[model samples]
Target: MLLNNLTKKFKHWLPLAKSKIEKGASQLENSINNYDPKEIIPSKLIERLNTKLNSLPVYESYYDTLTINVHDYIHQWIINKEQNRKNCLVIKGNCVDNLYNILTSIFSEKSSLSKETIELDYQIFSLENLKQNRRDRLNYLQEKILEIQQQSDKKIILIPDLSYYFSRTIEGLEVLEKLLKLLDEDENKFWIIGCNHWLWLFLVKIYHWDAYIENARDLPLLSQENLQDILLPVLDLVEFDWNDLRRFLVELPNQNEDDHKIISQLQAKYFENLANLSQGCLGTASQLCFYSLRYVKNEETELSNLKINNPQLPDFPSITQSDRYLLFCIGLHGHLNKSDLANILGDDQIYITSQIECLVNLNLIHFLDHQNIAINPLFYSKLTKDLKDNHFLVESD
Candidate 1:
C-alpha cells in the first residue's frame, strides 16, 4: 500500500518539480544576461551561474526533492520560547517573514504574500502589546498553509531557508527533530532544503560522530553537474575580487581604518582561495568561500580553527570535495547504499569508509540495518525527551 501511494505521488509530482526548478534556473539565466553581476545581484556571481545552468539539460532531475515544512516546526517552537522566557529565542525575524511570505505566495497567482494591506502590528515582542496578538498572527499564517496543502492536495512547493532555524544547540536540534517527524508522516511533499552557511556549520557540530559515520556510508556520489548547479547560484551571490572590492572599501567616504583593514584581509584571502576552485566544483566552493568572507560569529571562527589543524583531513582539494559532498547529502532526500557512497565521495571508497568508521568510533551517528543511517540511538532518545519537554502544544507559561 505504501509503495503504491508513493509511486502515485512521485509520478504526479516529479515532472511538476522539474518544471519549477527549470523555470527558476531559466529565470536566473535571464536575470544574469539582463544585468551586471556586481551591480544587479546581491553577490557578484551571475556569469558563472548563467554559464552552468545554460550548459545543463533542464528536464532532468538535478537533485532530490525533499520538502519539509519548517514553518510548522517554527510555529511550535515559538510557542515554547514564549512559554519559557528563560532561553532566548534565537530566530531572526526577517527569516520568519520570508518563510511566511513564501508559503502564502505559493498559493497566490501574483505571488504577493506580504500583509501590507492588513492592519496588524508586525512587531509582536513588545512589552506593551498583548501576547495574544503574536499567537493570533502565527495561527493565521498557519491556517494559510493548511488551506494550501489541503486545497492543492499537497502540491505545495517548498524552498526552505537555511537561516530559518539554528541547529548548533540542543534547542535547535529539537526543532529539526520535530520537523523530521512531520515530514516523515506527510506524502507528496516536494522541497529543497537550503543549508546555507550557518546550517552547514551546525550540521558539522550536532550530527553525532556515530551518526555522521553512518551517514557517510551508502552516500551518493556527488555529481559534477549537481555540484555545478548548486554552486552557480552561490558564486553569483558571493564571488567578489578582493583587490577591486578593497578599493571600494578603503576609499569609501565613511570608512574607519580598523574596519577597513579587517575587511581587506578577509576579502583578499577569500577571493584568492576561490580562484583555485575547478570548473566542476565552482558552485559549492564559491558558496562556502562567500560565507567565509562574511562576518562569522565566534562559534564559526572556532570551527574554522578546528578544520585547519585536524591531521586526518586531506589536502586542500580533497577537503573541499568532501565538504561539498556533505552539503549535497544534507540537502538531498532518500538514502544511498555503500556503492552509492563510493560513487559520490570518489573512487577512494575505502578512505571514505574509514572516515565513516572514525565518526562511528566518535559516536556521531548510527547505521540502520536497512542500509540507511540515523542519529545515534542515545541522541535520538535525548531528542525525543527534549521535544516532549519543550513541545509548544503541551506547554503553559
Candidate 2:
C-alpha cells in the first residue's frame, strides 16, 4: 500500500514538471526570435551610464546654486570693508564647502576689477610650519605680512585653515593672539581668514578672538531649490533609464502633456530628497551622491540598483575617555598629525596607536597624508552632534 501511494504521488508530479519545462522552452524560443539588435546596448555605454549615476555632480562653487545670497553677502562685505578702510574680514563657517566657496568667489574671474586689481598678494601659513618654536613662527608670519604690505598697495592675507594652528596649551593660544594683534594693527592690509566652525566657536569662548576681527560672517544653509540648481547641471550629463523613471511616475492621476516634462519633475523630487538628507551641506550632499549608487556583480542585470537614500552613520566601537578626547581635538583642528595629537592628548604614541587603528578601521577617521589624520567628512556632522550631546565639547550658541 505504501509503495502504491508513492507511485501515485510521482505520477501526479511528473506531468506538472513536464508541463513547466515545455512552457519555459516555448518562452525561450519566443525571446530569441523577438530579440532585436537595437535592444542590445553596448556594455561600455552602460558602464558609463552607471558611472555617471554613481558619481557626485560637480558645481563650480556654491554660487552656482540658488544659494547666491552668501556669495552676495561676502561681496557686499568686501565693498563695505574697502569703503570703510577696514583691514580684516573673517569668513567663518562650520561647513568647509561654504568657506571654500567664499574664497573661490573672491578669486574667481567673474570679478569686474582689472587683472592687477583682482590679483591676490597672499601667503598661506600651514600648521606643519608651526612645529618650530611658536615665538619664531609668530615673528616670521608678522614679518611676512609687513613685507607684503610694503610691496603692494592692497595686501590680502589668507589663512586657509586657521584651526590647524590652535592649541589647547597656553603657548599655542598666545601665538594665535599675537598673530591676530599684528594683523589688526595693519589698517592698510586686507585679511581674509577662513576658519572651521567648531574652532571658531572654541576660540570665541576660550580666547575671545572675535574682538580682533573687523567683521565676521557665517555661510547660510542651502535650501532645496538651491541644491536642485547645483545638481541639475550634472544630471544633464547622462541619459538615465527613462523606463525606471517612468515607473516612479506611474501613480500620476492624469497623463501629463509631455513625458519629458513629467520625468523632469520626478527627477527634481529625487534631488530634493537628496538635498534634505544631506541637511544642506554641499560637501555632505556630494559625498552622499557617491554613496547612493552602488555597482552589483549580477551579469543578468545591466545596471545595478541605484540606492537613493541617506547614508547610515558609522557605528563607532568601544573607546575610552582618552579616545574621545583625541577625536574631539582632531575634529576641532579639522586635521592633525600623530605628533600634534599626542602633544594635545598628553599621552604616549603607543597608547593611542591601537585606538587610532580601531577608529580608522571603523571608517570614523582616515589619513589625509602620510603624517596627518582627520575625521571622515561624511561622519563629521554626526560626530559633532554626538560630542555635543555627550558633553564632550562646550555647547556654542
The number of the candidate with the highest TM-score is 2
In model 1, where do residues sit more than 4 Å from their true spots? 1-152, 196-397
lDDT score for residue 396 of model 1? 21
- What digit string (tens of lDDT, one per residue) describes model 2 on residues 266-363? 66666666667667776666555444443333457655533233233344344445556778888776667787677777765755675676567555
Model 1 C-alpha lDDT per residue in residues 1-397, reported as the tens digit of each score: 9999789767755544554455456546755665433222323333454445445442122112111123333233334433321111122111101222332233222222123212211211112231222223233434434543454232323323433232223343555554443333343332223333223333445443223211111112234444434444444534343343443343443344576676546444434443433222233333333333432224544422101110011112111223234323322211234554444444445444544443333333345444544333222223223333443112222
> Considering every candidate listed, which one attains the maximal lDDT?
2
Per-residue lDDT of 128 in model 2 = 50
With candidate 1 superimposed using the best TM-score fit, by how many Å does residue 195's alpha carbon deviate from the native? Answer: 1.6
Candidate 1's displacement at residue 242, Å, is: 16
Q: What is the C-alpha lDDT of each candidate?
A: 0.33, 0.57
Clashing pairs in 2: none
